[model samples]
Target: VEEAKRAGAKVVVVLATQREADEGRVGRQIADELGVGVVYLHGIQFSGGDEYCEYIKYTLAALVAALEASSGAAGGNGLWPLLILALSIAVVAEAGLLARGWWRGGGRA
Candidate 1:
């Protein structure tokens, strides 16, 4: 963990128990000692299968939240949504033109 930190890597610890996550004992110590983020499995077990899927979802969400909180990079500068809207409008217009041409017997023999 310390080596990773020294290498400029973001460290996050995932514990398997609620007490470690909520009580702020083991998790807190680890977080403070290594300056890392800590997330617990909460209601789900760490075993493989369906529980593993849930853990993956939870871990991804936690990671995204941590990144957003730390750097605000995920929020963007508000231009992406506008670009997406413009792309959607352009697609809709193209589709409309195709539909209109089809309706007017564009492929007539």
Candidate 2:
């Protein structure tokens, strides 16, 4: 888990059955221990398939809200500009890779 943090992964999700909810709570403990965040989906009975999907959707939405709130509070220069810069870099790199591949007779195979 610490290794994952070092590798730039911020969020952790723990999905557990109703009977295993207590054990799944350990994810929250681990997140607290690591001073990171955890989102847990518990009390999910495997028998109810569609309801489980709704529960998961709600949990994911809540997690996304928490992350966005945290990012807003810890704003350096805001995320939009940073995201744009990152996207631009990715586009340029991809284009360069395609160009190089085309030069090397690797085009549109």
The C-alpha TM-scores of every prediction are 0.39, 0.41
lDDT of 2 at 68: 55
Can you write out model 1's per-residue Cα lDDT over 9-79, one digit (the tens) per residue? 44344554655445557656656777666554455545555444345455556655554454445558454
- The lDDT per prediction is 0.55, 0.58
> Model 2, 1-109: lDDT tens per residue?
6786686555556764522576567777766766666655554544555443345445545555455554546655365564555556656666676677788985653
**Least accurate 10 contiguous residues by lDDT in model 2:** 50-59
Model 1 misplacement above 4 A = 16-18, 21-24, 42-55, 72-109
Once superposed on the true structure, which residue ranges of model 2 sit more than 4 Å away at CA?
A: 16-22, 42-59, 72-109
Q: How close is candidate 1 to the true structure, as a TM-score?
A: 0.39
In candidate 1, position 53 carries an lDDT of 39
